[model samples]
Target chain A: MLKNITLGQYFPGNSLIHRIDARFKLILTALFIAMVFCAKTPAGYGLIAAFLIFVVADSRIPPRLILKSLRSILIFIVFTAVLNVFFTKGETVLFSWRFLTVSREGIVFAVSMVLRIVFLIVGTSMLTYTTSPILLTDAIEALFSPLKKLRFPVHELAMMMSIALRFIPTLIEETDKIMSAQKSRGADFESGNLFRRVKSFIPLLIPLFVSAFRRADELATAMESRCYRGGDGRTRYRVMRSAARDWVALGAAAALTAGVVVLRIFGL
Target chain B: MEILRAEHITHIYSPKTPFEQKALDDVSFSVSPGELVGVIGHTGSGKSTLISHFNGLLRPTSGKVFVEGEDIWAQPKQIRRFRFRVGLVFQFPEYQLFEETVEKDIAFGPKNMGLSAEETAERVREAARSVGLDESLLEKSPFELSGGQKRRVAIAGVIAMRPRLLVLDEPAAGLDPRGRDEIFDTVRAYLASGENAAVVVSHSMDDVARTASRIVVLDRGRVALEGSPAEVFSHRDVIESTGLRLPFVTRVMHRLRDRGFAADVSVRDLDEAADALLRLKGGGGRA
Candidate 1:
């Protein structure tokens, strides 16, 4: 059941979006998020939505997977939407029952809020879905390399991040194995009072933590045996280089942000 | 009467996902009282998945599992009870040990069953004895124990429950020859009561050939071959095709047979092979 976590999952494809430089994609994603927040009018949202749809299609990732990513946050979206619909005070009342009010403006606010959150998640997920974790971390290290001049451990941080990302699936598999082992011993993780259910996880957690520590210790030894010394003077096998497509993608993102800012200034 | 049975069990992992796989397919297996069944398979032959169903750790996608004549999943709420009835010692069980003391680790299974404190302690002692763990070591922390001792403690934890059917997955893996023999001996002794049965899952045919009354060879999630050790090992071609080999002595005997000598090709272990060779030497030259 732990395998259902689809966050940060990457789909490999030779599409135009996948071919874009990882660093540029990261910057473009940040720009898109800022532009999404800048969108205030319906026309602004429409423009950003159209851009996102086009990017999603070009990414060549299956639509079903993108929809699946949205499912994880469906509850949060609905909760916020409900809160906005019932609590926001507005001039044009659409429905009223006792203290709970659903006004025309409230409905519009709820829709806009939902759209903003959806765009934010979809846009960020697009970045992850297109770029591999290793490339993403490489881009992060590249973007933050200037911090090294301020005595920051940029390479060390990147190494730790890549290692953590590498072990997610391994740790997940270990968790599943330990859960099954404990379950065979008649440890019930399902169907109990809240305290009882939580208490059951003690057996599961203790073993998981033990195994994780053992694995980390072994990994450290293996790295040391190979003369790994904290990413000092490390040479890249695949150096990051931006191409014409990457520059065009960044230009489009800049243009979209400019358009949204213009729309906000005009109050359109 | 059969102690455990799986009828046409089929299991699919991560169904409908890109990583979807059919781990087991239309496999029927059963173990009777006083029987030791060996399930032999190479890696990814569905040996682990098949045994998981015997104790209701996993529900088959399209089949049924019966523990002592009752469908285990019939009352989903009571599946834990079935787990207690069918004790499973997972692969490399040493890594599963977590209790502070060896004694407490052994008692974990029985305590979960809600046994009285005295009963649980008594069972712990018996299990420790069965696995050859000393009472003096019980008070010591499990983490302080050696690898083999920790493995024994983990096995004793399941044995403390005294399940009617005990299933061990690759119990002898990653052990020296003596350690492997000790584990098999403990498994054999567990069946001395005549009321309990056990299933040993292993990729090594030699580990199970001597003790298993019957062997089931799994290949790509299907039961490729099933019979007594002598009966199954006789089909050398089929066993090899499944990515498994015959017991070492059996292969030797087969070699002798191929060289025009009258040797018992069914001999499973070294001692049996020695006796067959001695008899052949006494019987003049070739058959």
Candidate 2:
């Protein structure tokens, strides 16, 4: 049951989006997020939605999987929508009851807010679904290389992130094993009240934490024994290079953002 | 009466996904009381998946599991009761130890069964004693023990629940020879009551042959062979083709027979092999 997490999971493909340089994809995703927030007019939202749908189609990731990613945050989306619908005071009231009001403007605001969140999630997930975690971290390190001049440990931070990402599946498998072990001994994590259910996880969590620490320590030892000294004097085997497709993708994203800004400026 | 019975059980993992796999397929098996059933299969041959069904850990995609003539999954809400009846000690179970003290860890299972504090303590002590753990070591942290000792503690944790049928997956894996012998000995002692049964899953033919009263060979999710050690080991070609070797003693006896010595190639254990050799010597060594 713990295997359903699909957020930030990469799907390997050779589509145009997958082949684009990870650095460019990262920039494009940020630009898309910024543009989504700037979308105040219906025309701007429509443009953003069309661009997202196009990106999702071009990436070739299964629609079911993309929808599954959204399912994880469905509660957050519903909560925000409800908050905006009942709390945003407006001139035209659509519905009213004791201590609650839903106005025409409130409904519109809620729809736009939900759209913004959905677009933001889909846009960022497109980046992760196309680029492998290793390449994503590499892109982050490259994009933030300027921070090195400020004496920041960008390389170390990136290395840590890549390692953590690599171990997620391993730790998840370990948790499954440990959970089954506990369950076989009559540890009921499914039944009981909320407190009791959470209490049952003690047997599961302590062992999981212990195993995680043990794994981390062994990994560190293994790395040091193999003469792995941080990012100092490191050389790259797969250098990131911009291709024509990458340039075109970036230009399209920039143009989309500018168009949204222009539409907002014209009050469309 | 059969302690456990699996009827045409088939399990498919992640069904409909690209990673879909049939881990078990139309396998029917049963264990009578006072039987030590050894399940031998290469890795991913569905040995682990089969044992998980004994306790309702993994519901079969297309079959039923009965514990003592009652369908285990008949009442899904009460599945935890079957877990108490059929305890499972997982592979590398030592990693599951979490309580502060060995005593508490051993009592974890019995406590989960909702036994009184006194009964839990009694079972804990009995389990610790059965596993050859000292009373003095019970107070120390399980993490402070050696790998073999920690494994024993983990086993005791399950045994303390007093399951009628105990299933262990690769219980002696990665242990020294003596440690392996100790683990098998403990498991054998647990079945001395003549009212309990066990299914020891392992790839080591020698360990299973030494203890198992009956052997079941699984290959590609199907039951390839099932019989006593003598009956199963006689099919050397079938066993070898399944990517498993005969017991060490059986292989040695076969080699002796190949070398022109009139030895019983069906010998499944060291004692049988020794007795066969003595008879061969008495019969002038060659046919």
Candidate 3:
């Protein structure tokens, strides 16, 4: 039942976005998110929206999959929208009921807040969708290499990230198996009171933790047996390099940021 | 009478997605009371998927499963009851052990059935004895047991439920010879006591050859062959083509038959093969 999670899932493709360097994609996504918050007018939001729509289309990831990720945060989005709509003060009130006022500016703030969140999620999902987990962590390691001189274990952190990414599906599968095994023994995880339901999960959780610890120990031993001491003197089989298309993508991102800044200043 | 039946069951995983796969396609089988049925297939041949349907653990995409003449899915909420009636011991069941003591672990199923503590303990003790678990070890935590002991405790957990139809997926996998023998012997004794039935999913022909009253071979999500051990092993070409290995004794018998000894290649056990050779020699055939 946990299979529907698409948070870190990657879709294999040969699209232009998929071919961009992982480092560039990460930078572009950050820049896109910054531009989203900087926009101050309908036209500016529309501009950023149009650019995002194009990027989504160019990435070639199915719209249904991108929308699936939004399901997890739907409640948060609604909460943010409601808070912005009722709390923001304005001179022009749109409605008032029992001292609960909804102002015109409040409505605009809510709409913009919702749009920015949705856009931010979709824009960031595009990066994960286009780039494999290993490459994404490799990019993070490369971008954070300067911190290593300050004693930050950048490579180890990246290795941990990749390992965690690698096991998400495996652990999910193990959970499914354990759930079935327990169910066969007449352990009911569904159809109980709130307290009873929480209590029922005890059977499932104990086994899951045991298996996870077992896997971690085996992995550590396997790595040690292979003489894996540390990141020093180690070389990666696949190295990241930027190409012409990556440069063009980075240039487009910079232009988008600059354009959003200008639009915010000029109220376009 | 048929104890459990899957009628033209078809299971599709992740339907309506790019990753959709037809794990089982129009596969059908039935187990008679007191019958021991062995399900053999190559990996991805739908062996695991097929057994998951027996107890309503998996809902069929386009077919139905009946437990003793009633459609199991007729009342979805009551599927939990069917689990007690059709106990399943999954592969590597040892990993599912979590109870503080072996006795409590075995009594888990009975407790779920809401049985009284006295009755639950009785069932747990009986199951432990049947599985050859030492009575002294019942007080210890399952985590403190050896690998084989842990596996037996997990199996006993289901056996304590006293299901009419017990389904196991590779129960003897990853075990030493003695461990495998003890597990199968426990299952054999369980079936011998009454009209209870079992379906053991395995890839090991030797284990099935010595135990199963019938065999079902699956290939690419379809029932490729189904018959008694002798009847199924006789079709060597079909079995080999499906990527299933025949019992070592059966293979040796086949080689003897090829050498013009006029021996029966349908033998599934060492004793039967020896007897077949002795019979041929007594008839003055070439050794």
lDDT of 3 by residue, A7-79 (tens): 5789999999999999999999889988998998988899898998898898888888888889889999999
Tens digit per residue, CA lDDT, model 1, B1-287? 79998999999999998889999999999999999999999999999999999998889999999999999999988889998999999999988888889999899899999999999999999999999999999999998999899999999999999999999999998999999999999998999989999999999999999999999999999999999999999999999999998999999988888999989988878988889899999886796
Candidates sorted on TM-score, descending: 3, 1, 2
Clashing pairs in 3: none
Q: Residues B122-233, candidate 3: write the lDDT tens digits.
A: 9999999989999999999999999999999999999999999988899999999999999999889989976999999998899999999999999999999999999999
TM-scores of chain A across the candidates, in order, are 0.94, 0.93, 0.95
Model 3 lDDT at residue B73: 96
Writing each residue's lDDT as its tens digit, candidate 2 over B113-227 gives: 8999999999999999999999999999999999999999999999999999999999999999999999999999999989999999999999999889999999999999999
Candidate with best DockQ: 3
Model 2: runs farther than 4 Å from truth?
A85-104, B249-263, B270-287
State the C-alpha lDDT per candidate.
0.93, 0.93, 0.92
Cα RMSD for candidates in order: 2.2, 2.7, 2.0
| Interface RMS deviation of candidate 1 | 0.8
CAPRI quality of model 2: medium
- DockQ values for all predictions? 0.74, 0.78, 0.84
Worst 10 residues of 3 chain B by lDDT: B278-287
